[model samples]
Target: MIEIEGLSMDRDGVRVLDDVSLQIPDRSLTMLIGPNGAGKSTLLGLIARLLRPSAGHVRVDGLDVFRAASDAVARKLAILRQENHILPQLTVEELVGFGRYPHSRGRLAAEDRRQIADALHRANIAALAGRRLFELSGGQRQRAFLAMVLAQDTPYLLLDEPLNNLDPRQAISMMQVLRRAVTDLGKSIVMVVHDVNCASFYGDRIVAMNAGRLVAMGSPKDIVVPSTLRMIYGVDMSVHEVGGARIVQPFS
Candidate 1:
């Protein structure tokens, strides 16, 4: 479980997060949803230890994330930010291999090789392994990066708006891959999603944030109601159920 207590972030005297507290249960898929500038990404950075919170604490399974050693935290959690800048000349395989550095220490062993292969397969990018990042399309590059995160083989995974430039098919495929990771491998996946429909379909739990604070949290059915949607996005939306999954129709 991840426990966030009184989390607040400040930048240049501007408060981005305000006394935010959350508890993310283990082995569950939680989706964070909010409008722009709601501090979702800032909170994610704090949880991943990418940035130090000005106040509060983040504990991953009782281990203080900020106080823990870098290697120890890396072993337990993996994070993929939305904006990642990598060398354009690097091959997908080489990029994925970097994920093993916590364990391999720059020298990949047999286990690392196996993990790399598994991650490529899981992300459906096995054929793109040898291709240079610049040679691939936008969606393909996203898949390659996702493969790198998967190769980390951590129990907790945090992804920030991973569907940024993906096409519809690629987005669906990625969500399915995440579902497999949770159901088959028992991984805890927390992702920030812009598409309410995508979060409705894939998330076991939906957390809504607005103005740098958590506003609502529940199952999709509970959080996707008309009132909740209006409260969070300040827009009236229609809700539909198809094949037991809730979908939000924001544009009518």
Candidate 2:
């Protein structure tokens, strides 16, 4: 479980996240949703130790995330930010192998190779393993990066806007891959997503944030309701049940 207490952040003397506390249960896929500037990414950054909070603390399974040893934390959690700027000369296999750095420390063993292969297969990118990062399309690149994260084999995965550059089919496939990670591997995942329908369909829990504070957290059915949608997005939306999953339709 990830426990966040009194979490807050300030940028240039302006508050971004208030005193927010949350408990992310283990072995669950939680979706973080909110409007732009809602601090969803900031919160994930704090949890992943990419950014230090101005106040409060984040603990992953009882270890203080900010104070833990870098390698130890890396073993426990793996994060994939939205923007990745690495040398494009690296092949897909090489990029995925980087995830094993925590264990191999630049020297990959047989286990690392096996994990990398498994990650590529799970991400549906095995065929692109020899391709250079620059050669793939946006969706394919996203899958390659995701394969890297999966290769890390951490218990917790934090993804920020992972669907940023994917088409509809690619987006759905990505979500299904994540769902399998949670259900089959028992991984804890917290992802920031803008699409409510995807969250409703794949997420076990939905966490709503607004103006840098958590407004609500519940199952998809509870969070996708009309009132909750209006409160979070400031827009009226209609919710419908389709094939046992909640779907939200926004009206202009």
Candidate 3:
């Protein structure tokens, strides 16, 4: 489990997050939803130890995330940020292999190779494995990055705006991949997403933030109502149940 206590961040005397406390349990997919600049990504960064909190603590299964050894924390949690810019010459497989560096220390063993191959297959990029990163489309490149994170084999995965540049079909496929990771592989996932319907359909729990504060958190059924939508997005929207899923339609 990931426990966050009194997390806060200030940049240039401007507060980004304030007294945020949250517990992310194991084997669940939690979607973070809010408007832009809501500090959703900032909170994820703090938990991943990419950013130091001004005053608070984040513990993953009892290890203080910010104080733990870098490799030790990397082994427990893997993060995929929104912008990943690498050498365009690297092939898909080679990039994914980088995820094993924490375990392999530059020399990949048999098990590392197997995990890389499995991640490639799971991300549906097995056919593109040999192609250069620049040769792939935006959506395919996103999948390649996701494959790298999967190959890391960490128990917790933190992704920021993972659905960016994905088509509708690709978005659904990615969410399904995450769902299987939770149900079958017992991984915990926390992601920032803009699509409310996608969060409603796939998230085991929804965490809503606004202006750097956590405003609401609950199951999709509990948080996908009209009032919550208005509270988060500042828009009036209609929510309807369709085929056991809640769909959000916002007004223009």
Q: Candidate 1, clashing residue pairs?
A: none
lDDT of 1 by residue, 142-203 (tens): 89999999999999999998888788888888899899899999999999998999899899
Over 205-241, each residue of candidate 3 has an lDDT whose tens digit, in order, gives 9999999899999999999999989999999999999
What C-alpha lDDT values do all the predictions have? 0.93, 0.93, 0.93
Per-residue lDDT of 38-139 in model 2, one digit per residue for the tens? Answer: 999899999999999999999998989999999999999999997899889999999999999998999999999999999999778899999999999988
Candidate 2 runs further than 4 Å off: none
All-Cα superposition RMSD per candidate: 1.0, 1.1, 1.0
**TM-score of model 2 relative to the true fold?**
0.97
User: What TM-score fits each model?
Assistant: 0.98, 0.97, 0.97
* TM-score, structure 1 vs. true: 0.98
